[model samples]
Target: MKVTESPSYSTPEVSKVMDQSRRFIATASDRPEDIVEKADTEIIGLALQMLSDGTADQVIIVTNDIPLGEAAESLIPKYGFTADQVTWLTGGELAPELKEDFVSEFD
Candidate 1:
């Protein structure tokens, strides 16, 4: 979805978070021209917004995308959130029980 189409994007805080995520991804990527995807950034942006708005004490981002996870980790601290305040998990790192459930759902 376009960033503007996000229901939460109408809020100033969400909008700011989204912009930060986009900028970070652009500058951080080696191939800046190839990093045009915004969905992953939007997910990170919403997670950051929740932390900023006090909606969540901590946020855990579970994704197989390594770059996206790294981006979230790097950007979290820039927004005044500490490492302990957020967790990034890859599919391989998921607990056995969650992995079973995850697989079952897709199957």
Candidate 2:
């Protein structure tokens, strides 16, 4: 339940994480040429930073963006986290009760 701002993009660590995330997204695509860019790099960079800095052992990136989730899943291991330690939850996959609450709050 902790909320924190994304790490500054100017930091070398954040920049590195963002580059890694973009590369992962491009590689995972069927049409790498069609992939323009990842707008969620900042979020992905922050998540990686938490794991890298020992701020969190596990991170669950809940989002409706499929590419964002895929990149996070693919790169988490490079940040020293196992697949089990990272989770990606799409909005549709949330439990029914929680889904309603989550949607309502956002709406």
Candidate 3:
């Protein structure tokens, strides 16, 4: 699952989490674990990192999967991401739009 929001809604906690995630992604090793299951933390870190990196001028992610949805919601508060910084796209299945879940702002 993914969300799309403006920076205005970003919270301190979210910013901090995003920071950690970004750092992980920017410097990840080329090893298989770095890009795969061995690095769940690294994946989350990379996802958030991409969001702040501006990989796309505009982006949105849509998903209704319980694991992803719940985790995303929980992480928002824990991370302090604002409502706007976070978004939910209601749907029955994952699709191309959801691919933007990894939006990044890095050059």
Candidate 4:
């Protein structure tokens, strides 16, 4: 589980959470089907809407509480987005490998 913040988390906070998740994933080998008892259905619909309406270049996180992957996946057919449209928010692990303007100023 990730600890998200309102108004979004900073790069440092995101890094911290990702690091902890790596440790947890390494230690606890649990299946998502059995792990998550109550799923957030609202998020799925919301994400789908955002994905359909929002541009691929933009990340529209309406409620910061929603998981990034969950939110992105919900978009699916809305905007014709594949895994390529979404990038894991890696602090710096693959920054050198990125070709898109993920951190660039938007118009």
Candidate 5:
């Protein structure tokens, strides 16, 4: 599992969210899957790079935005990636299982 974020998260509010996530997963390392600017436009490319570089055979994109998920789906075939190779989570469906104490520290 890897985490990816836009460089724009350096701003105050987004940085707060990033910090909260880090603090919540205190034992985890602070490294990201990749740090790139404009994730909205670059994530698909990054995914391809990961695949081509053999860094990941499968990728699960966890996001809150519907369109971002859709865009990823549309680009999958164009990049010779298969449906099973990519997974999408547009909601926090996986969040419920996280430790409550860690989750409550955010939002």
Candidate 6:
């Protein structure tokens, strides 16, 4: 699990419960010097590491962030992952053009 430190989100609390299912929680730092502010960056990094290290056969990303999902999809193929091995879940299944509706649900 990837957790972002935010005033609005209780990441630590969530992480404790999620830890039972997954071993580690990739926590993000609140550094003003950082380029990226989202947890997606850490999530993507962990996913890539899992693939390259041969720890996971496939990586499934469950994010509402469109750019992060698209960026992850582009990089997964470089690690020898096929289309079937890389999956994105944004709440519901929808066509790429209709994904905007899916994203709106989070808003």
Model 5 pairs in collision: none
TM-score of 5: 0.53
Q: What is the per-residue lDDT of model 3 for residues 3-79, given as tens digits with 9 covering 90 to 100?
A: 43334324454456544433443344333323423233333433444555655322233444333333444454344
Please give the distance, in angstroms, between residue 86's alpha carbon in candidate 3 and its true position after superposition: 1.3
* CA lDDT of each prediction against the hidden true structure: 0.70, 0.73, 0.41, 0.36, 0.52, 0.51
TM-score of each: 0.67, 0.70, 0.35, 0.27, 0.53, 0.51
**Better structure of 2 and 3 per TM-score:** 2
What lDDT, from 0 to 1, does candidate 6 have? 0.51
Pick by TM-score: 1 or 6, better one: 1
Q: After superposition, how far is residue 65 of candidate 6 from its true place, in Å?
A: 0.6
Give candidate 6 regions above 4 Å deviation: 1-35, 94-107
Please list all clashing residue pairs in model 2, or write none if there are none.
Answer: none
Residues 1-107 of candidate 5: C-alpha lDDT, one tens digit per residue: 77654334334433443343333233232334243124443565556556655778987776654444555565554556798887777445568554343332113
Best-to-worst order by TM-score is 2, 1, 5, 6, 3, 4
Q: Highest TM-score: which candidate?
A: 2
Comparing 2 and 6 on lDDT, the stronger one: 2
Q: Alpha carbon lDDT of residue 56, candidate 6?
A: 71
Q: Which 10 successive residues of model 4 have the least lDDT summed?
A: 1-10
Point out where model 1 deviates above 4 Å: 1-7, 10-13, 27-29, 33-35, 95-107
Arrange candidates by lDDT, descending.
Answer: 2, 1, 5, 6, 3, 4
Q: How far is candidate 5 from the true structure (C-alpha RMSD, Å)?
A: 12.3
Q: After superposition, how far is residue 25 of candidate 1 from its true place, in Å?
A: 3.0
Could you give the C-alpha RMSD of every candidate to the true structure, in order shown? Answer: 6.6, 5.4, 11.0, 13.6, 12.3, 11.0
